[model samples]
Target chain A: DVKVTQSSRYLVKRTGEKVFLECVQDMDHENMFWYRQDPGLGLRLIYFSYDVKMKEKGDIPEGYSVSREKKERFSLILESASTNQTSMYLCASSDRGPQETQYFGPGTRLLVL
Target chain B: QQQVKQSPQSLIVQKGGISIINCAYENTAFDYFPWYQQFPGKGPALLIAIRPDVSEKKEGRFTISFNKSAKQFSLHIMDSQPGDSATYFCAASYYGQNFVFGPGTRLSVLP
Candidate 1:
């Protein structure tokens, strides 16, 4: 079984503070992704990394960035957290293949106050 | 614009009844479709998936019905149970690319 783990299950930060969400996968998957899920909005991609040091912007990449220094770890960084940035952050990893099944972490519920 | 459209934002079904959720995609390049189930406070988990080549795929009580020409697909839950209640999201992707998820449907199975 693929295991994806996040650094935090819940976090609260003040406005204009820097925040970091970390994700690690044990499956040695080549593809990792960050997504923010909101009510009625579903899961919107924030950023994705195909390989080490390789990053791609998804549909909603504003106010956020990513780092993939290693294959097992992917981190999401908020330059300066704002109240609007509060959301449930999910990290997923998938193997490189024709039919990839993304395994997601439990998610970090961030609250930017 | 939403690439994938899902209908019935919410659904309530009684136990032993069937629960159906539908999704349609506009992208012709999409060949893989998957359904995810998300419980409260938990991340979405892959439930079942189907490809365009197959019209239907069943895993236990969960079934995926696909319509290639119409660019549509659906998930059918037989013998709905209270444990089946969750948010179901339909997604589309080209091969193994980044998946575009639907708006999602909140299902409630009344016991």
Candidate 2:
């Protein structure tokens, strides 16, 4: 079975603070993605990395950045957290194939106050 | 722009009844379609998937019906149970592009 683990299941941060969400996958997939899940809006991609040091902006990339220094780890960074940034963040990894299934981590519920 | 559109934002089905969710995509390049189920406080999990070449694929009580010409696909849950209640998302992607997910459907299976 494929395992995708997130650094935190829940997090609390103050406004204007920096926040980091980490994810690790054991499947050695080549594609890693960061998304924020919101009610009614569904899952919107924030950023994705196809390979180490290669990143692409998804539909909702503002106020967020990503790091992929290694194949197994991907990190999401928030420069200045705000109340509006509070959301459930999800990380996923997929193999390098057209139809490969993307396995997702449990997710981190972030609360900014 | 929402590339994929899903209908019935919420659904309630009784046990032993059928639960159906529909999704439509605008991109013809999209060849792979997958459905994901997300429980409360949990991440979305891949439930079943279908390709354009096949009209339907079934796994247990979960079935995916595909219509290539209409650019649409749907998920049918037979004998709905309380455990089947979750948020279902339909995603579309091409060979090399990232997936575009639909708005999602919240299903509640009444026991």
Candidate 3:
């Protein structure tokens, strides 16, 4: 089974604070992605990593960055957390093949105060 | 602009009835289409998927009907049950690329 685990299920941070959301996958998939889910907005991609030290910006990459120093771990960093950044963060990983069946983590509900 | 457009933001169906959600894509380049079901407090999971080559694909009571010429596809849930109530999202992606998800439809099956 492909297991994707998030570092935190819930988090609260003050404005202008630095926040990090971690995700790890056991399947050693080559692709890892970070997405923010909002009501009526669906899942918008923030960043994605195809391989170690390889990152790509998705549609909504502003105010967010990603790190993939290790094969199993992918981290999302917020330079300065703001109230608008509060959202449910989802981590997903998939193989770099034609069958891109992304397995997702439980998600981290962050509240930026 | 939304690349994928899903209709009926919310739906209500009685048990044993049919629940249908529709999605249309603006980018004809997309080839892989997948539907994801998400329960409250849980991450979305892949439910069913269909390629443009097939007109229809079915698994159990869930079915995906696709129309390549129109660039539209739909999900049909037969014998809707309370447990089937969840948010359904339709997504389209280029082969091996990032998927663009629809706004999603919240379905409620009345028991």
- Give the top-scoring candidate (lDDT): 1
lDDT of 3 by residue, B1-111 (tens): 348999889999999999999999988777688999999978998899988889999999999999999999999999999999999999887655567888999999999
Interface RMSD against the true structure, candidate 1:
1.4
Task: Report the Cα lDDT for candidate 1.
Answer: 0.92
Predicted structure 2: lDDT: 0.91
The Cα error of candidate 3 at residue A63, in Å, is: 1.6
Candidate order (DockQ): 1, 2, 3
Residue pairs in clash, model 1: none
After aligning candidate 1 to the native by TM-score, how far in Å is the CA of A10 from where it should be?
0.5
After superposition, the stretches of candidate 1 with alpha carbons farther than 4 Å from their true spots are none
* Candidates 1 and 3 compared by DockQ, better number: 1
TM-score of chain B of 3: 0.97
lDDT of 1 by residue, A1-113 (tens): 88999999999999999999999999999999999998867898999998999999998999999999999999999999999999999999988766666889999999999
**Model with the higher DockQ, candidate 2 or 3:** 2
Give the alpha carbon lDDT tens digit for every residue of B1-111 in model 2. Answer: 338999789999999999999999988877689999999999999899887899999999999999999888999999999999999999987653478888999999998
Predicted complex 1: CAPRI docking category: medium
Which of the two, 1 or 2, has more lDDT? 1
Complex DockQ per candidate: 0.63, 0.61, 0.57
